[model samples]
Target: MRTLALPAPRRSRGRSAVFLAAAALLAGLAVAPAAHAGDGRKAEAATLHDLAEDHGRYFGSATDNPELTDTPYTELLGEEFGTITPGNSMKWDATEPQRGVFDFTKGDEVVDFARAHRQRVRGHTLLWHSQLPGWLTSGTWSADELRAILKNHVQTVVKHYKGKVFAWDVANEIMNEDGTYRENLFYKTLGPGYIADALRWAHQADPKAKLYLNDYNVEWIGPKSDAYYELIKQLKADGVPVHGFGLQGHLALQYGFPGNLQENLQRFADLRVDTALTEVDIRMVLPSDEAKLAEQADWYARVTEACLAVKRCVGITVWDYTDRYSWIPAFFEGEGAALPWDENLKAKPAYFAIRDALGVRPKKT
Candidate 1:
């Protein structure tokens, strides 16, 4: 996280005919004011998803099973996003609480919602260090025993959701901040080879679905990202089926923005794997002021622009759309207001900034 001044907003109204057609779909919805809200600037009619689709990218948000019951929440989720991730439903504890019994009731709810809205789905995680079921974490197993268990879990989940989920975070947050592998249960029992094994099992279950290795704090070309660079390179060399890299862009104002984000993504693109901003949000110290909010907007714009600049960078997804459902304050003590929309579901400056980043150009008169 390094500090840098945000660039001024650029203005140009010329746009493609296709954009104008798509913007018409935004009519009647509560989209924020145009990039230039007042000042006689023409209004923007397209949703963030609509504008993003124009560039062959998707704008998405993560939704939990509980939030699906909220009508207002679901309405904005459907209208604004082109893709969705199940925040916790697809995790091990939720999907497979019992040793061999699998329950997909919650994950299915998210997939069903995504399908109804015509939005693609990103399967949040197949393996991770957190939120694991008590049975799996508490039990002791030999190398062979754990390997079998891991494979079975992956294949069952992938096959059950086959052809529904477009991408799966086959592995998540498996690296340490200093570029070493994290000693999670899988690693402790199965050692480093487990990474390749997990990716392979997931691929076997569904060859069509893209497999991604996701982590946080690796948004720049640092030791952590460097570890992934080498790991991915080795995976490819060994003919593993890894297809993408997910940089969970969880930023904090106190930490500053990631350094050389575009450059970092480009290096991964060189490995022929797709990249995405998996869980993006810029949180600030509590009691948010105008200056802090403005800085947050600039960070949002920068993240979007970084993704757009890279050819292989597929899309961007906020942790959730509004601060109403944000997981920040709950975990980080006093740090909240991390999303583009406020708790009331009203658009913040970050919303307009994201629209601008997505090429929401007004028509040239």
Candidate 2:
């Protein structure tokens, strides 16, 4: 899960501190020509999906069940994107509220929308420490008991959406920032082997679906990312079913862009697996100024370029399309506007910058 706002700038003390200070240099990269503003007027244009498709990639966004009823909001999602990941619907809490029972109502809604729009679907997560049902979280179980439950959960969820989803984040945010596994329910009960077990179970249920281990803060080469690299490398050696590594590219302008982001993604690519910017949003401390917005746009363009540059980087997905429902403000005080579109669904500079980065030719009006 994404952490709170970045720590305030501090005097360089070590490698991490020095890397954090490099945000300024990252922001100084040459900016792309900005595209026209998204004025909410429907016009003939090269949509992000079309441009990305030309480059063998799919552009996507995450949407929640509540946003489905908003006609304009859904319209934008259906038109401008090629893939949809239900932000919370497919999580354990929403799927299996009780021990044995399962619910597909919320997740089905998103899948239906994607089908209607001819967009692909990505299963958000099967195992995550957060947003779990009370039943699973409150009760304690032995290692064997917990392992059985986890297997059942993974198998059942993967089987239910077998043919529908193209990729599944089998595990989410299992690693901490310091390159260690977080002591979550599964880790505490079953230990680190749980990751491999989760991936194996998911593959057993749906061999066709691409299984992935997804996390945030590993967009660059750091302790956190290094841990993932080692883990993924080991998994590959063991012939595990780990198919992809997801970088939940939740970025903030205050914290400089990740160092060697392209190189970091390339390293994962060397493992012969796919990579994606699973949940991308560049935020700044609120009351956004022109400079901050411009910087945000630059970051967006750079992220798109980074993915495009890497052959194994499949695509990029924003946390959501518009800032009306961004999770940043709710979690981080005085921080919002983390999306390419504004609360009013108007395309900000970042939107056009993305089009430029994707090499979309301007459509004649």
Candidate 3:
């Protein structure tokens, strides 16, 4: 949160041809501006299960094309999952891998799908240290070049999506595990001030969109979490237009989840901004580990209950809808099945636990 002036750009080695091709396709698409239906009781009538509810701001998920039409995500979720993040559809590398080039075809598909279904969208991220084009990390551009690139990238994407997206994770995973700032390509090239600039630029692109700074492991009170807390306070004081904080609640049973999560959420609410339990999933070893499964269910219930208890905690989004699509196993190596539903689209025990925690009564067949 400390205001650091923008630093000099590192360098850029250039981008890949494949990345550039995809980016071009995104830029060429004819995206019509989204129409705001306004907030009203009629909009609220579409219960969280109706995809058209547009209120209560409950659960959301990162969806793909196949799932958009064929899976239970569209059917079972209905209006309940109002907000949609592009699982991996709108990353920096995907949107604009090369210089000055922008591609939003995949992301646009998501937007189109959401619009067709009458669901709201949350832009997954605008800036992040991960999943960036190799050229960005190559460190070839001057500070000026990088700044222009960053600004243009943000402006273009925001302009394209504008009213279609309700909120955005403007800057992601900027803090280190110790709660100190992590020096990624942006930080290394542009310095600490880049965070504020990113937020400001994103706001310029779409003033209506609620911008948020997102990170994982901030659900508990610790050095890292505290660092983010202080950072938000400082940004708020600076009048940065930062409207919310996204707690990437990716938990593991072995790590021993936060003991005082409800208190932690209240602290953020006290700051008078919205909060969301983004990318939530409690993972354990597979092959039906009943004891660990039970523990996972308990943890899921706790997270859901905590979010519900906090007034400003608007929504909770699982990383993936089903274990089959979960990124945990690939990322965590040995971690498996980390979602409310299994690959077969059957509800896991954790699913029922979360539903009950949310005060949602199961429908009798």
Identify the runs in model 2 with alpha carbons over 4 angstroms from their true place: 4-44, 360-365
Best by lDDT: 2
Q: Residue 291 of model 2: what lDDT?
A: 61
Candidate 3, which ten residues in sequence have the lowest lDDT sum? 1-10
Cα lDDT tens digits, model 1, 182-241, are: 899998898999999999999999999999999988887878899999999999999999
> Model 2, 199-235: lDDT tens per residue?
9999999999999899988887878889999999999
Q: Rate the local accuracy (lDDT) of all candidates.
A: 0.85, 0.85, 0.72
lDDT of 3 by residue, 64-92 (tens): 65566665556654344666778777888
On TM-score, the stronger of 2 and 3 is 2
lDDT at residue 183 of model 1 (Cα atoms):
96
- Top candidate on TM-score is 2
Q: What's the TM for model 3?
A: 0.81
| Model 3, runs deviating above 4 Å | 1-55, 65-74, 77-80, 360-365
